[model samples]
Target: MKNILHVFRHDLRRATSNVMAVIVLFGLVVIPSLFTWFNVIASWNPFENTKNLTVAVANTDEGYQSDLVPIRLNVGEQVLSALRANNDLNWVITSEDEAIDGTKSGEYYAAIVLPPTFSADMMTFYSNGSEHTKIEYYTNEKKNALAPKITEQGAGEVSTSINEVFTEKLSEVALNIITSLSGYLDDADTQATLSRLQARVSGVAAQLRAASTTADMFTSLIASSRPLVDSASGLVSTSGDALQDATGALGTGKDAAQSLKDVLTSTTVALGDARSGTADSYQAVADSVDDVFSSMNAQSASSADALGAAATRVQTQIDQHQQLRDTLVNDVRPLLPESAVDSFDRAVSRIDASIARQQDLHDRLDHAATHITDTDADVQAMHAEITGLIANAKASVDDAQSAYTGSLQPKLDALAETLSVIGGDVDSIGSDLSSVAESLSGSDSLTTALEHAESLTTDISSTLTETADRFDALANALTKAMDTGDLSELTEVIGADPQALATHLAEPVSLKRVPVYSVVSFGAAMTPLYTVLALWVGALLISVSIRVDPPQGAASDLPVLTPTQTYLGRFGIFALVGFLQSSLVCLGSVLFTQVQPEHPFLLILTGWVMSLVFTLIVYTFVVTFGNAGKALAVLMLVVQISTSGGAYPLQVLPQWFQNISPFLPATHAVNAMRSAIAGIYQNDFWVSLGLLAAFALPALLLGLVLRLPLIGFNQKLLRALASTKLM
Candidate 1:
């Protein structure tokens, strides 16, 4: 301990004895502090001056014509307007090509471009399903790394401003809509109009329902008529066959009459034989007539029945048409405007015409059926008359032989005339049957009318369904609105100032940040790192410029010092110099810079302790290993700068650096200073200060124990450096 004090005092006296030595010592003390002051000042408020970083803004947007609002929209222009008012960055308005070129050429930090379709694309927000608009951002990442980050922040600010603007505009539109609706609700005339509209809608709905029912009935009528139509078709076929058979029978009867006439008029035949043959021929004609009549009777009965069923079906269809026409006229027409009434009237006329045609077909079918019944009765009467004529002819056969030229010939002629008349009547009946068949076959008008009615029914049903869905949606929306509040309350809310509401809606939430241990400026927050770094550098400078070893002859009179005592003695001088350096840096930071540490005295004390520790560590390296030790100190300084977490956090460093950070003296030094500069946690300051002081122990061991073996090697290395003649 005595020898340690002796070496410390001896070095101090030698340094102050000469003016040159004192000047050198003064340089050493002030130089390291200058490094800290200048660095702190340079980075004091770097972010505050970011307004000098040039960023290009290019607007190439075409205006968009919006149907929602009367005004044309240009989102690019609005964005540019917002940016022009912003002072966060140096904004330069230019063309797209120029902005792109400037960004690529390093003339600008970044460029934001609004393309020609920017405004048009923004209008797509009102569309149903459209992609969002894009604002092209170009950045030169090769520029200063920090500058690019600041420019990116500027871009984000622009995006946020645009969002605010969009929100404000949308709020204004919504407010306007609400105000308009409120005004409408407040007006008496509007209320009346609304009531009338509701009534008209209700009426239309009812009319639709009635029309739908009528359509259903018409469709049912068509469906039910299918069987009747088939039956009518069968009747037509049967009637045609019956008519053919009657015609053939008439021709056969006519031929028999001709044969009888020829037999009666013959010269070579006997009277009795002619009479018998005439009787047989007449009987044969009667039998054929009777067969034809029976067939006609059956066919006519079936035809009449089929015609009656078809007429009944036609009547039902006509009734449905009349009901539909009534709905169109009474319920639907009054709701229609005059211009539409003509069209409605025309439609009704068409329906009436259809009904008339259907009725005509019904009447024709009825008339044909009546004619068939009358013809059937006439055929039965004719058959009875023919049977009587055959009986009289058989009884007159014997008498007819006596009066051959007189009574027999005349009677034969009369019977032949009767047969001819019956043939004509049969021909007339055949013509009536043909007419019925033609009428039944030509019933395409009825089919066409049924098809039209079915189509109309489908259209009405679809329209009714759609209307019902729309009404349901409207009811749901109104119900939800009423659930929140009544319409009167909504109107009252809308009565407030719209602009204030719009502004509130635009920015509904705000962030309130309460900083936890706030430092005033960048330089103030960074003071701990730079001040600590300067202390290390100051220790390094002392190791290089001043000698760590006491002079060999000056300490010769003292007791021979042990290596531990020598090491402690030399570190005492370094420690004094380091304390002066730390005091100067700490005072400069507190007095001259923006740094205002919470515990200013503690900051100075921490600095002093760190300086002592750092000085001892560097001094040990140099005194133990000669010039190579100085190189090792410089290398350590470099490593500490990177790993100490002074400039950045330890977590941000590489894994190896973070692992070694806790062991580094500068790391602990910076931590202790930070605790003093900001608000100290429980034992953070003491812990850091103790960790930093602990580094001095290993340094002492290297100097006291490790150097004992390297003393010869270090001496030879010094000799070799001296041999170069540079020092």
Candidate 2:
């Protein structure tokens, strides 16, 4: 440590003793301050002076109007107004061609263009809800990157302002349309519908009043039909009873037919007996024919006359029976059902056969009588003929009896069966009619209910007719209202104040800027870079005039100081000059004068550390290689200034620069100072401070650790250069 102090004081005395060295040291103080304050004052806050940068604007929007919406849209004019009002960007309005050329020529950072169809596209959106109007934005990337970026942001703001105004105007139009619809639909507007509506109400009332009257009328009509239906039911009942009586009468008729059959049977038997007697008498007469002829000779004519009369009488009786049979057939046959008519015919046929046989006998008698009369004239003339005639009559009588017995009883049985069937059918009919009558009697309530239903139908029909009239009135009323354009009240509901609406739409959001690291101005925010550069460059100047180590030819013969002592002594001298440079730059660069740092003491501390580390780096390099080493130190200063994150963030630099940014001492120095000035202690703050401190280690190690070899190599090179007369 004493050796280091001894060398440090000796070098300090030597520097002051030389007038040129003293002047160089004084220049060091002035130069670093000049580097920091002069540049900082020149480009202090570029963004705040952006009004100097011109951005071209071209608006060729042909204004459009829509008849469907009674409004004209002039969006380009609105944008111009907004642009003129805004001071954020210097917008130069020009023709499309000029704006395009200006942007291409780099005269403007960016250009904004409104197409000729801008308002037409907007009109299309309002007319049929289609299409979007696009604002053209052209940027010059060929220009510096920051100006174009800032100009693009300004262009976006212009578009947003115009769109807000467009939306506000469009909403007003839509609101008015809705209001017009409301007015058109207002129903209270005077119309013919009022009278029609009243008429409909009157018709409905009239129908309601007639409902009971129509019902009662139906009741009366139904009541009148009940008696006629009852009469029909009664008539059917009487017909059934009459059929029953007719059935009883037919039973009596059957009994009478049986009686007649029996009587006919008895008569037939009598006729048989008479036929036998006649046959016997005829035989007797033949035997006594001679004797009888003599006895009847005198009365023969009278006898003939009597026989003729008997024959006539028999003929007359047969005619009477036939007439009676005809009367019975024509009258009584019709009285029975057709099934019994055949029985009546069979009975009458039997009677006709019997009577026919009787007629034959009578004819025979007449002939015999005539013969007798003739025989009187000629005695014993026709006795045999008369006998033969008598025999024939008897035979006929027997045949008549046979015919009556054969057919009459069978016919009577048939007539009896027919009468029995007729009687049963009549009884069944009577029973059925009685049942029908009872059913009709039980249906009295059904008739009343049916009558009520008919009454209701008439009432409903009347109601429907009245309702139809009402509906007609309603339809007429609706048509009248529509023709007059009357509907409801909504016109005043959806209205807006234009100014208020525009204000609301214009800037819907506001920005509240809260800086984590507060800097008074953009210039102040960048103070760390200037101060750090000044500190580092001060170190390079200190190495120039001051001999960093002993001359190589003389270094071998000098007092035996250790390599670390040699390094510390030289670094100590550079440190004095570096700190002195830091003080002047920090004071002049607005470290506390133009801008108040959050940590003024820490900023001074940062500057001091940066100077110390930078001086060590240069001092070690110059000591190791003499004049060549000084050249290397200046080269390092150039590399660090370009690659360091002090001027621009390392992130924005080329990748190769970023790869080495962390290793640069100036990068760490600037970061540390930035933390101090801005009052933001980010991790980079401590990391950068630690890195700056760490850089001191390598400078120290090279100055002390490999010091013997480096000094030997530097001395040898120095001698070689001196020998060539280059020093």
* Top candidate when judged by TM-score against the true structure: 1
Q: Provide backbone clash counts, one per model.
A: 0, 5
| Tens digits of per-residue lDDT for model 1, 1-727 | 8888998887888889999999988998999789999998999889999999999999999978767455677778878887899999999999999999999999999999988987777667777887787889999999887888889998998888878876776677656654555346546665554455445555665666676677677777776775566577787788778778877876876776665555445421444444455455545545544554566556767655655664565565557556655655565444333444454455556556655655665565465456655655664664465456445544444343443454334555666677788778877877887787777775666666666776777777777767755544433433333344245544444446776777787798999999887888888888888887788889889988887666565646555777777778878778888999989888888888858899989998998898888888788888887877788888888898888887888788789999988878888888888888888899998999898889878987888888899878878888888999995
**How far out, in Å, is residue 45 in model 2?**
1.8
Candidate 1's clash total is 0
Candidates in order, TM-scores: namely 0.57, 0.53
List of clashing residue pairs for candidate 2: 185-487, 185-488, 186-487, 186-488, 187-487
Per-residue lDDT tens digits for candidate 2, residues 620-639, read 88777777777897787788
TM-score of 2: 0.53
> Which portions of model 2 miss their true places by more than 4 Å?
104-109, 123-132, 138-145, 172-496, 551-562, 590-593, 651-659, 682-687
In candidate 1, the residue pairs with backbone N, CA or C atoms under 3 Å apart (3 or more residues apart, or in different chains) clash, namely none
